[model samples]
Target: MRGTLVATGVVVVIALGYVLSCIIRPFRDCWVCDGKAHHRSKRNPKLSRPCRWCRSTGKRLRIGRRAWNRVRRVQRDA
Candidate 1:
């Protein structure tokens, strides 16, 4: 019984991880900044600029093209 329970838990965890990955694959960068949003500057005391990578979007993609490619590979495999 314990073995069965463990197996079920493993499947659930894998499914949840896959679901989470799919949930955030569309946007290129942070959901808020689209990878370009920015906030006020602390050093300048009066400067504001968009984020180069994420802008205001908190999320950052290390390799956007690679992520897209992974998605394609997943789709093909599926």
Candidate 2:
């Protein structure tokens, strides 16, 4: 039973790792500022700017299912 529990935990960890690896963007906009670091100027203290890269969505890019499958196919063929 202990071994089974360990195996389940390992599987869960692996799945979580895979999911995390799929995240291309770990933040929104510049990722360095959380969309606010760049505007930290004394001249402009009220800049509510959004990140151009993530469009203010604090999520990473995810591989589309079809594109992932296509890459997998190429790798398998190789």
- The candidate 1 region of ten consecutive residues with least summed lDDT is 26-35
> How many clashing pairs does model 2 include?
1
Q: State every prediction's TM-score relative to the real structure.
A: 0.38, 0.33
Candidate 1 Cα outliers beyond 4 Å, as residue runs: 1-4, 7-11, 17-36, 55-78
Q: In candidate 1, residue 34 scores what lDDT? A: 49
* Residue pairs that clash (backbone atoms under 3 angstroms), model 2: 29-51
Error of 2 at 25 (Å): 7.7
Residue range 19-68, candidate 1, lDDT tens digits: 56656663445654444477557889578876655645666553544576
The parts of candidate 2 lying over 4 Å away from their true place are: 25-78
lDDT of 1 at 69: 71
RMSD of each: 6.2, 6.9
